[model samples]
Target chain A: MEINGVTIEDTFAEAFKMWGSRLIITAATEQWAMTTAQAATGFGTSIIGCGCEAGIGRVLGVDQTPDGRPGVEVLFFTTSKKSIAPVLLVRVGQCIMTAPTSACFNGLAAEKTVAVGGKLRYFGDGFQSSKLIDGRRFWRVPVMDGEFVIEEEFGMQKSVGGGNFLILAESQTAALEASEQAVAAMRQVPDIIMPFPGGIVRSGSKTSSIYKGMTASTNTAYCPTIRQQVESVLPEGVNSVMEIVIDGLTEGAIAEAMRYGIAAACQPGVVRISAGNYGGTLGQFQFHLKQIMA
Target chain B: MGSQLNSEKTTAVSINDDGVTLRLKAPITLPVEAESICPDCFVGCQQSEILALPVFCGRRRKMLGDIFSVSGEASDRITVEGDLTHFKRIGQGMSRGRLTLRGDGGMHIGAYMKGGEICVEGNTRDWTGAHMTGGMIRIRGNAGHFTGAAYPGEIRGVNRGTIIVHGDVGNETGARMRRGLIVVEGHTGECTGAGMIAGSVFVFGKLGARAGAGNKRGSIVALGETAPMLPTYQYQCRAQFGFLGVYLRQIRKWGIAVSDDLLKGSFRRFSGDVTALNKGEILIHD
Candidate 1:
């Protein structure tokens, strides 16, 4: 399937079921909200090593937030239920709590709620008070500046991870530009996030590595693009290949993001567009390149 | 709230109301010895969580099957269908599920609600939703003193959740509420939002004295009033806060009738309680 002279690899991206939570962080200003969300989602690229994958889902308008403040929606995914609590405590505590005039809330309200504020409220050292409004609980912990409000518990639900695509361009600049545009487009869509440092993943790993005690192998197929020639080679005229990874509340959202991302990558000097699929993890539904175009 | 039952010899049956009463007909005798029982103790009689409750009843801290027969499903819902005039702690520290009282209930319909909904079809006594973290409460009829207010030693009333009363309430409505929205369709007693750090109280009817004393950022909407409010408040002219409209509309869908005047009314913003904390402000109707 060729789209605008760019080959859409007849392959699929492999993904796995993950436990996910959406964290809504509100701050005094848009900048603080974005900064806190970005920082919280940073370094979370792949669950392979980072233990989680996350991204900023959207830049929320003040009117849409619970506190009438600018906010950002962040999506974080982990392999297990137990793995989720630590990520929440560390990320929310360090990033959001550190940010000025910021408050955090759980985006998902599900059957079972986990304790986020219950764990973090101790930062106030018995100075925290809780309020239940509309059947949801919120805790107000006294902070140095004023007070930090967070939901007493967060809802957790099943999510998907590792929905990814590669951006292939003639020059590194073009690849970077296309990747940036694609990320911007995906950011507009809700319930999905790109957890990489900057929504761009330069390192694409195989299921496992050849090295001892290693679990991930580099995708040598898209090298040169990297340096030093290896067994697999990059297509000619392909100066760079950057991957866009996605983690969302649902598989449909991740698939939707890939559609937009691949379309955005089909610009000048682009050689091909493909996905890192795990042979046929997608069941019952497949997002075809031709279908996406139509 | 009253329900007819045929069970006899049901030991330690407790009806949480004005009195934690346990009564047995002369035909049946309860077996539990020592009293001062937790509600959980009654469940052990049949090893079930269903405890019959009324608004007010006679009790023996050291008593057995004080009032009525206890029977049926020990489900998440605990329903009482009697003349619960003296019910106390109708729902004490209920961590989950629904608790419904068919008739008027006495003090503390829901003291500490962690989750779920509690509906009082009839009027209720005081201290409702005290220190609650989650869930909702709707009192179809009037309520007595401290509806959604704090206990004496405590400084705040309801910690979280929403409380909607269809009728009038006694003194200290939502006293020291840290957060949450309390809507009273009828008149409210004095000291509403007293020492409140944050939260909102909407009284469609008249509000008595000192509605917002020491409030940090909470709002009290008196659609009809005798605003003998504290002098600490410096009135900041009337202006409509859009959230009030949204909130009123939300309650409307939930079956709480909040008059149109409240949604479209101009509110007087009083930024004070500076005596205790400068952060608090009282948003009152102009």
Candidate 2:
């Protein structure tokens, strides 16, 4: 299949089952809300080194928030349901709670939930107070500027992670531009986040590594410079490759994002679009590129 | 001032067309213990059985049919109509279903209620929702004192639930409340939230004198005028409270009007009832 004359590979992207939580951070202004959300999701790109994967999902207007303030939605993903609490403890306590005019609320509604504000209330020492409204509990912890309000529990659910698509272009500039367009398009899809800087990963990896204790290494087959040194997957005209990794609350969300992204990335100078997979052996979910574009 | 707060009287004999309704035959002067009026009591019972439910009229045993004319089929939803000013414990210990009282009700309207909803279209007397563990009670008109308060010997009052009084309330509202919320849109009588343990009482009208007198860890928010604080209370600070915005927005859904200034306003905090744990706070809108 082809989209705008760009080849759509028959390969699929393998995604693993993960636990995820959505947080709605609201502040006095939209700027403060984005500031706090960005801070809480900082240093979070891949669970392998960041302990979790996180990104800002979207910006919300005042009418959409619980507190009637401008807000931002953030998504956090962890390998296990049990690991999500500790990750939230650190990010919310060290980042969101420290920001000015910010308050955090659970954006998801699920039966399974973990305590975030219930544990963070200790920061108030003996001054913390809780309010139960409409069957939802919220904690008020006294801070230096004012009180930091957060929901007592944050809902968690099974999520999909590592859903990726690679953009193969004729040059470095073409690959970079296509990746940017794809990232911008994917950002419009709800419940999904591209967990990479500018939603583009230049260093796509393979499962095998040459160095000891390194589980992953660079994908030499896609390296244009190494075409003569190894059996490269790149065609004669292909010179650059950039990947966009997606994490979403559901498999369908990831597929929806990938469809929008791939269609947007099929611009001039793009050679083809493909996905990374381990021969369909590891991840629980797989998104076929041609099927998605179709 | 008292006439201004009277809610529009609902004259419908049956508030819910599909539910069982009990219409009083005539006005009564003597207090009647009518805990059987609760929807939980009528659940699964036939229409005849509901009419035969036992009640106490001034220490005399009587059937519910003796005082009121029962109608409709058996269901978990019940509607009571007419002058109920002398009926007590109207929905005591009810755990599920809905109960609607169309006129004034007597004391202990929802005492020990565990779940479901009770809507009082008119005024309610003292001890309403005493020791309630769950559910919600919305009083459209004035309420007598001890609303959401504990029994004389119990440690907690309205442990879990919500009580919203749209009109004024008599003294000691939410007294000894351990948990839950109580919102009064009009002025409260003196000593409101006195001896509160842990709960929230938001009064949009004038806060009565000596409020939160012995509160240990509760919050009393005064959005309008407030009476003079007691000597046991100490000024804390004047700062914006983020949590109040959340509470205000939630309450607005229940037909309570909220102004933009109050939704994004600052409050003067006073930590007190130092004579007790001194952890309770009174926040007056600034």
RMSD of each: 9.0, 5.4
Residue range A1-294, candidate 1, lDDT tens digits = 777788877666667788899888987689989988888888788777677887778788856767556788888889888899999888888888888878888788777567988889888885465555465566777666656888888888888877778887888898888899888877767788888767888878776677899867878777773555576546777878999888878888877888878887787777877777655754323455555555
Candidate 1 wrong stretches, greater than 4 Å: A207-218, A225-228, A277-294, B1-181, B185-187, B190-286
- Candidate 1's error at B78, in angstroms? 19
How far residue B127's Cα lies from its native spot in candidate 1, in Å, is: 11
Q: How does chain A of every candidate compare to the true chain A by TM-score?
A: 0.91, 0.99
User: What is the CA-based DockQ of model 1?
Assistant: 0.10
- In model 2, which runs have C-alpha deviations exceeding 4 angstroms? B1-17
Error of 2 at A233 (Å): 0.7
- Taking all chains together, each candidate's TM-score versus the true structure is 0.63, 0.96
Clashing pairs in 2: none
lDDT of 1 by residue, B1-286 (tens): 1112213322445333332233232332222221112233233233233243322223333222344444443244455566665546666655555667777766666676656677889988777777766678889998888777778998766777888898898888888877778889889888887877678788878888887777776767676766576888776555554345446666776787655566556677666776876555565665
Score each candidate by Cα lDDT. Answer: 0.70, 0.91
DockQ for the candidates, in order: 0.10, 0.65
